[model samples]
Target: MVADAPLRLSDTNACVDAVIERVGKNITLGLPLGLGKPVRFVNALYQRAKDDPSINLHIVTALSLLAPRGSSSLEKRFMGPFAERLYGRIPELAYARDVSANRLPDNVKVSEFFFKAGSFLNNVDQQRNYVCTNYTHAVRDLMALGVNVIGQMIAPGDGSGQVSLSSNPDLSLDLLPLMREREAEGTPVAVIGELNENLPFMGQHAAIAETSFDVLLEHQPSDYPLFSAPQMAVSPADHLIGFYASTLLRDGGTLQVGIGSLGAALVHSTIMRHKQNDDWNAVFDRLRVADRFPVATEDGGTEPFREGLYGCSEMMVDGFYYLLDAGVLTRVVYDHAGLQTLINQGDISQQVSLDTLDVLRREKLIDSPMRARDVRWLTRFGIFRDTVEFKGGRLRVGEQSLDADLDNADSREAIRTLALGDRLTGGVVMHGGFYVGPESFYQALRDLSDEDRQRICMTSVNYINHLYDHAFGTQRLKAAQRVHSRFINSAMMYTLSGAAVSDGLDDGRVVSGVGGQYNFVAMAHELPDARSILTLRSTRQSGGEAVSNIVFSYGHCTIPRHLRDIVVTEYGIADLRGQPDEQVYLRLIRIADSRFQQDLLKQAQKAGKVAPDFTLPADWCNNTPDAVRQAVTRTGDEELFPAFPFGRDFTDEELTLGKALQTLKAATSTRRGKLVTLWQALREKDEDGRYAALLQRMGLENPRGLKARLDRRLVIHGLRKLDTPSDTGSKET
Candidate 1:
């Protein structure tokens, strides 16, 4: 029987009951990765599974957004208050709680295709159960593994009652038709949807028929907003990395960026190049971008963009809005191959007018004898309206008619001047798979006029992640539009051989899954002019000790050394594509942190990956974090490198406390540091009352116990450290 019109359930329990009735016991459930999970329904289902052992549950999903619960007293004291303030009213994830506590029942098996970065690093069960797959193939792989039930959160419908996939149309759109097919075959596939009014109702493929789902759940939308990824503070090192990556992007090129501090920094730099050219150019000169990377000048350009860029990303981040607002993302490429080619070659602008038609005709892109199909193609590009029709050998638009036989001189002139008319504008600045941004980003999308919304096409991940079209012919329109594509992704560690380890540890524990990084890397190599730019911080602090992220070799690789194209760090960029093993090693070491470079070079030399005769340059030796800060500050504009470029969720006071708490946590990571911090704190004076509210926020205003007093002292020490300027300067040691 055809799936009945969506049956609205009263509560989450009712929804669970309906799911049980539909799919029965021993069911395999599928959920969207993140943001699109129906929290209430998932919690109820998990509860039911706990009560009923016979109902074996295999939950296939990824990126469970769990609240941070500190492991120790000090950690708890700091994180508890911070989480409460930053994540107000956002419901705790029941599944994540079970996984974190190892309280999951034996009958229920939770397998994730992706982890919320570093969330499952310590969880043995999650690490062993992690599914290795790309983002574009997630749904397909899950279906092949027999996921009988699929559920997701959605935005409420408009007047016609058409609900939208909203925050996550990522894989839902791809899975819906498959579910429908299964339902038709009497296999009992259930598509569950819950309406959350807080989600912005997106257009395009995001909108779906009301009857598409087998069961629908709705309630008075929560007063709280959707879960937002708090904006990360951009450091000077992050700015340097962004500055290097920005220099590699050519004008009128395609860009694919992920969501993070690096993305925000990159957008800031791109905007500066467009709006504040003098300042941007001056910074480039200071960095010696043209001299250091001569390949950048050949592959990219140092000049400010005369023709702006077009965005094509799997995730439409908040920074895209900032880029759009600053007029840096104004390159609009159409879906048609001919039109895109003309735009790429600078033969035609996005503004389609009579003059552009004349140019197309002069270039022989348009035929003199325009056929009926040609008229239809022109109409699709907004060159002609629906009121215009080509009948016989004439163009009929309302009462006015013009001859289409351009072979006749007068007819050709009339067709160019009058037939096309002045109404000419059709192109998209970006083609995104799905979007999850801050409240401001959502508001911007919600407030857009229908016409404006059309310019930001929201499609499926399959198109953005892959070049070959599975649905259409092999020669897809998307493949043609993607020109000089730069796929910028981040990695946790990289080997000397250019191998990347983005998701898992060398010991087999997963930090995060291979989302779309591999897919982009593969695509970069496939496309002739495209390049994958992997951005990584040279070092990270672990347990109060600094560790180099660039290693001699790694046990497991996400993007193998063979696929490596461009690797960038705060110090510099390493163009590793097709380079010898020794050259790749030397280039990566050159861009590594100064403290770690000698050690890395020694390791590489010991392994015979680099020549022993090679020596580091004197100037390049100053690749310290302090050096990066000094270089960035030399511009003398504090506003140029604000922590959060777009916007931040935390208040000014919260940000201040957060930074202090972070410092305290860093200091307390080691016993010796903790003792030193306490001693320094006890010797200091707190007469200014600057940390009064901060102490109160951390429950350290009035110390009642020994631990509380120590914690208070730690905070005080951290604050004092922040107040004092570092004496390290640009020294390597």
Candidate 2:
């Protein structure tokens, strides 16, 4: 009679059976992007499909995280131990593994809306099935494809009587209402959740009642370690690019950055500006940033933050954690629209007083004679103490009872004496949708107190990415919160016409899906005080040669010329928001690598975008590979711009060997370079046991076969150079 209302909570295998039974053979199950998928349930279902070819299963998702499994013998030898140390027993998603290796059966199909940034360049199957959609539009598109079942990894909660959608509330919170609507329309839709004890419990909108799920699975066998990717080294070019971008951030602004060393570099620079203002000022003055591009000085700052920033990134990378620790991300915003606006206009301080109540009363957010709802709202934000209670239109403080009329002077005095708090509560300093980072980041989050963890709200992507929807608040409130916002993202190639190439190539093969880059860029144009800053190295190595990332034109564009606001490379900054064609061309060319400026200028002249007789400026023609290196050296900050600003998981031997191997790989990328490397390796007189530890780490200490001997020789040759350049730039196909 209750229609299975006893609350069916089972294990992984039982839940998999229930899902198949409810959704039938042709199930288009939906999974959350990244670390939130139910790995055990998904693997069981995939095995069922693989074992029985009659079962048709098509799944849709994005950013499927995979642990490293090196492709070749040499790479395997290097990464095997490293992988075991990091991702110990994390269960790899069977569908992702199969789809990546082109080993899926005929009856199983998997598609993703995003890839882990250039992980699928030559993958024909993944490139073909990739669904291109903005991050905010994922739920609508997933529904259009007839997604019937959904599953997620959840924190079962620490006796809080709620389940927390930790790590990912991005897509599932947006898709749940539609799934319920379909169920009401006589369609079979299953909502399943698998419990993981490792995820940190995220409160607020991410926590929901346990009755929300149709089936809940808590199994001991499924308890595995969460995946933690190794943090890579930040290059010298990344530091300078980050420094240039840091100059553009205003005090008390908003920030949204992606996950990687580039964003960490920017965070490092921002922290430097805050903690070591003298050094930051020194670097700023030495680079002559104000002379060539006055926008950095006029529109930005070189001093420290008087009022800290608010983080509004969709992915809460570890950089935000660092900022929070350094007291740089301490600016918080409340949920009340009127109060947020007042805070933005500086009418009331975070410190609560009689003035705050007066402002709220004047704004008519609360009535003179407070109702129950009004009293509850005030107490919820800690404007009033919990000791204050409302009963029959009267206020009850700890030992005093008084009338609740704020317009009356006696009642207001009573409130100020007993009910008012010193500061506001229920304000968030950061709002993010999903998060993925190093193991240390996860541990830091898990170790936070309940009070501190709730200050970072992990909510739906709809609320975080754009202000078009009214699910959370109005666009006006968002505008007030996101003041002078900076959305810094990476780019693959930039054209002289001010277009950015980020996701794909001209041949229509996607390097990564258009996940949220377009959403943020379009949002940057919509917000009046906001700017989109695209960062890239001035040059990248291809075929053992440095090639300019700034080109005349590219076949495809991610952000069109009309949407370009700011572009930052190691050379300098280019302001391109509302400039003319000639000005955009000149500014972009001036920031290009010095070796490629003339060629780019000639191409622009051939296209008639620039004048035929235009001459390159003298001051902007010194953007060599070593320019940033030398500038950093002059400032005596080589130690500050470390290879890994954050602590690393790699061993000491591994770090040295990894860099040497990278140099060798670059040296062997071309035919001529390969010949030179081979000849040099053959004649290497590495007799002195200088590379004994490195050789033993790579498993090449004693060689037997010809291949092993060659590997040993290559290792010896790779170890000959220890002073290799630190700026191995970002690469793309």
Candidate 3:
């Protein structure tokens, strides 16, 4: 493979040329489809095609095709209610246009775009043209689209050399082996770009030599900014849902968390228990206790929960980082590491030393420095040991252990000192990057070495497929059973039970997008041990009138009847999963919003979906939203409300703009022209003067106003509010 290879790496353009030379005219690019590198590659491909028309560029993957015109709001699109408010008012505000321009690069066309079918991550129906079973299938489909050469543009190590396609491992799917298979056949010319130069990772089937890629381009790795946890107002209802879900979490159970307010709030709540409840802290302390007086049990005489909960799943997001920081999880082992080493590694068996813990404490990796109280509590727990080594002399359990001879008296004292050094510090987990929101958690995980990194079970990218297969397997773990739950959320679930869930008010088209609610419902029926938990917010207040989320029916049904599972509200849990039509309606009505229960029961009678004798349960009727609200409400201290529980760092002005934009969105939905005119006025305003004034206020020279008009919306909107200066900083009406 290394016959006449050059000694050093080639540049990006040189790599492209070499690949072209090896293969010939037509080329296909299997890109990591995100807004980041893919956009640049497609732009370059179009530019390249301007000169060399023979080189073909085809894309085969899912990309987030957003609504056009982006958000009129100042914040980023992915942020919660702000985005919902902005996008939801589409028809009235004319914001329903596709965000991603449908127009393709002049050289590359959508006709050549291949998509993945049955994709859990993206919308299947929207993905038109050629579709395949998976990412690998999509790649193969690209070859059929007249692609003779494959181009991979992943950033390499140190951001400056050729990176083997194998090295950039992802949970989704790997393309290297398939690429090699094509190479074994007649196909050749793999172009691999190595961008990063500092620390490069080496693992898995992630190895490719210089000969593997005809072109090895050197460029800087694209510095993708980390996604900070977004701020959100965790409503009383949402917090209750979180508390219920928290109960489902076992002490040692692994967690798979989705992104957004729910997951972020969950992380915050878990952290809160350490400060709020002594029992929670005690449980954590006992679990961290070491096995000094090892029980002679067959389970290796080791404390069972001592290893703590291992995070195993695809996303290595903030929550995983949180567990690591809290000392609830430690020890990561790579797949290839020998199993025997698991028993022998000192770091694997031991807790973090006091010195390490102190260092982290000083650095603010943890919330605070360890106090005498902490040491006493930790000592009372099993985590801290009382042995010593002679080398370091006197060592505390929270400090470091001595290496002095155990035979001598002095050595024994040193060993005892060292035993005291052993404190509860995180050990061994795979982690990287800067996490500011949940920094403590991130710091703990990253404190581990690469070998120990594997033990963490933090990445479950393969679980998507593994769980899919496991659903049919004999023994069911927690992960497999959850897949069946997806079916209840399916769009047409109720249709199977001879009922539909749509509102009759379809006077004109609404701005509602077809979300993934239906897909989950369908999957619920397909898998065992899985059911959908349909959540309705009870009553929604609009225009001074409170409307029930549970209507006689929705104008559009995200999920149908047969797919309903346990529907929960403040009223109570309504077990509807696997119930007959009459029972389902009766149970659903029992737990619906209090104000609409009577009306819903009458309508259910009209539709014959309910039993004629079904009556609203008296006990269930007693618990209303107001009652539930009062029960959980704190007398004072707005911070205790759990609104923005994970918390946000935005200025008050930004908050006002966010709320105003939300109001505009709602107004636009019911009334037209108002939002469009407001948006136009905002968009047309000269932002340069404002930016210059901002720079002057900061005592810095102003940079040219080169940022796009849309980019300035966030800052401008915030600044615009300061000019008004009311208590809430209300903008001019």
Candidate 4:
């Protein structure tokens, strides 16, 4: 590649041909994990590699967002039409299709750093080829394995003649500079970028020059919409967990949240606290938040946010947007150390004006003999224009020049009035490494004004995930801005000893990679005023059975017991930090579901971790899902605890059908239930027109063959069961 090479604009096929011509056979391709992969370009490459086996292909990526294809007949009947309606006009993912069908060519190999939800559960090839690494270190590990070509999807910048990495600057921002360095040293590396108008034009480090890529592909901005994960519904159990977690949040603190139903629930509860404080307090009173969990009161605030919050997350999900719109994410932190220190000490607000300058001078935060670096810092913050120059005790802006003598009243007055203006008013409300949300989220980001867009800084994962001691001179500033930080994440299972298993199973099969959960856990302990809060449901449904998530012990642990801080379930909150083994075991059991509490206590006693005569309190026996629902339902406002608080893609009818289908699937999961369901289905009748539309929607309207008739009968019986209001025992597995 030549230095300052002109970016060649070409079609997808031409771009792939150029790449193939350059790298020839045995090409090692690198792409971002999620929404960043260029769909058309990757599809063309996959087709080319498939046609010619001589051209060996090694694809490296993770989290390929593909529409779900059901593995069973019943699942297929329900999901086929649902996915078609949900994902309109989005092109079929080629690599995902081939992998799902187990039809990859002999010369093509796919390696992933992370797997999509249950995508590799039974696939031997993908399981064996998985690469386990953290999100912040994925690029380093891939490059060490000699990944030579990189491609990604990007959005057009705002009239800057540049492009934005948009949702996936996580690894590319750190990898691009290194790729350029290698090219400069006579090593050929190809960086391909494709422009899609639907992606949001993010600011900060996500914006890059057009020349950063060797080849570029452009299509109509409306030709493709950004791929997104549909928002899941928040159950009553999820809402209760959120209610407990909300009491543990400080007013003027930093927040970190992930993408899931739990994260959505947390955002909902926080919004309620800020917008409807009386209702929130009522719910808190019913739950006994202060009485049962005194640590929440000691560390967190119950009153509404007067100072607001700032967000520092590895992935910016749509929940943050909802928080921002509700005015709960209004706290701003600056990038300069002096300003951050003042803000941390409550000496100055986010508004930067002459009053701020006066406060700085009165506090002696700045001196008269200003250093050159200080002048540059001031310029960077827009305190002075780019034309301003500092040299040997003098500052010049445009045609005006002033001495750096702070003691001189004239010089001080001139500097304060002229150099410090209202241009440096805004500060960042959030700093995120990358973002991927619903289609509405992308539209919200794209419609933001330049000023609002800058407030949500998109940068590298290193800054958001860990404290970099060698981050030039900004480490202290970063640390100061992160005071009273709370990193909230989700886990799958947690042991009585406080060890958490989030990313894998005991059999050593990978469910998901260790992506940034460990990073936040470590950082929570490393920071003085930070706490890591991990949330999980007290029980999970598996194979038609309800299993307790709080186990006696787990074989594998993603986060060790030593790093435990706070864990929340629907029942209550557990503060395990620095607690003894017996105390930790008891606390964990206290928050478990009532059905499993006795069994957990017995297991703890057997292991000698707790006393033999120990028993759970009678007051804590109300830790059931039914109790959670009744408490929220008694508020007389059903909308307060909705499935999707912000918005949803599915229609009301679709949601109803989906729920009925889920109940049916769960009913037929066991052998005895299957036989009983079959017997009931044979005697049932759908003579009424109530379920006609649903049957047509599921493609079982007119049954012809014996198999189709049997499927329809079973579906009809399941639908009747769903209509029965008394049946609440079934859960989706």
The per-model lDDT (C-alpha) reads 0.80, 0.85, 0.40, 0.82
133 Cα displacement, candidate 3 (Å)? 6.4
User: Of the candidates shown, which would achieve the greatest lDDT relative to the real structure?
Assistant: 2
Candidate 1 residue runs with Cα over 4 Å from true position: 1-4, 221-224, 353-373, 390-394, 409-418, 421-426, 472-476, 675-690, 724-733
Q: For every model in order, what is the number of clashing pairs?
A: 0, 0, 77, 0
Worst 10 residues of 2 by lDDT: 724-733
Q: Could you arrange the candidates by TM-score from highest to lowest?
A: 2, 4, 1, 3
Worst 10 residues of 4 by lDDT: 724-733
Error of 3 at 629 (Å): 5.5
* lDDT for 360 (candidate 3): 35
* Tens-place lDDT digits, model 2, residues 1-733: 1143324555666777888778788889899988899998899889988988878999999999887877756677788888888886888888998888989998988889989887888888888789989889999999999999898998877665689998999988889878989988888988888888888788988998776688888875558877886888887788889899999988989999998878988998999999899998898888889997788876678878879999998899989999998888988988877888899889999899989988888998888888888889989999999788988678888667888887789888988988898899999999999998888998898898888898999999988898877688778878888888899999989999889999888888888777788888888899868989999888888878889999988899988888888999989999998999999999999989999999999999999999999899888889886677777668776576677778888999888777777767887899998899989888875688888888888888887898888878887787775543333433210
Clashing pairs in 2: none
Tens digit of lDDT per residue, candidate 4, span 1-733?
6337545665788888878766667678889878899998888888989989888888999888887768667678877876887676788779878887788898888999888756788888888889988887887887886777889998876666689988888888888877777777776778888888888888777888888888888777435877878888888888888878888889999999988889999999999999999988888887778898998898887788889999999989898988888999988878777788887887766545656656766776655566677677667776655667787678887778888666677977887766665556447899888777888888888788877888898888877887873432356777887888899999999999999999889998888778899999888888878889999999987877789999998899999999998999988899998899999999999999999999999999999999998778898787887787786678768888888887887776567677876776677779987788778889877898678887887688898898888878777777787777677453421
Compared with the true structure, what per-residue lDDT tens digits does model 3 show for residues 1-733?
Answer: 2224432343435555655666665666554332112232344444565566555655444332232223343334324443343334321111101113343434553331221112212322233443423322333455555444444433243333334232123311334445656667867646444333321233222323444454444444542222123455666655544433333233333344434445554455454443344433342233221221111121111223344444443234456566665665443322212211332333233444444334334444332323444334334422335332223333344445333223355644553444444543323243211112232333343455654443343212223223343212222332322321222111111222323342112432222222233433454455554444444345555652556655565444444555566554434445566578776776666656678778878888888887778777675575466554653453233444356664464444345555545544443454444556346436634345754544232222332354434434434443444454561322211
What are the candidates' C-alpha RMSDs? 3.0, 2.4, 13.7, 2.5
Query: What are the per-residue Cα lDDT tens digits for candidate 1 across 1-733?
Result: 3454789885888888888888898778898877788887888899899999989998999887775768766568767866776576877768778988998999998999988888888888988888989998898898887888888888887669799887777788788788778777888877888888777777766888888888888886542467667777887888888988988898878899988888888888888877888888888899888888776777777667777788989988888878877777777767676677776676766565656766677877666577688688788787766567888777887777787765677876666666664544567887777676666787887787877676777677887788776752244466668888899999999999899999888788888889999999999998768889999989988997789999888898898888988999998899998898888998999899889898889998998887888888887799887788777889968777677777777766567666666776777689998787777877765678888987787777888987878778777776777666672232121
Cα RMSD of predicted structure 4: 2.5
Model 4 regions more than 4 Å off: 353-366, 369-376, 382-404, 410-417, 423-426, 469-474, 728-733
How well does candidate 1 match the true structure in TM-score terms?
Answer: 0.93
TM-score, prediction 3 = 0.56
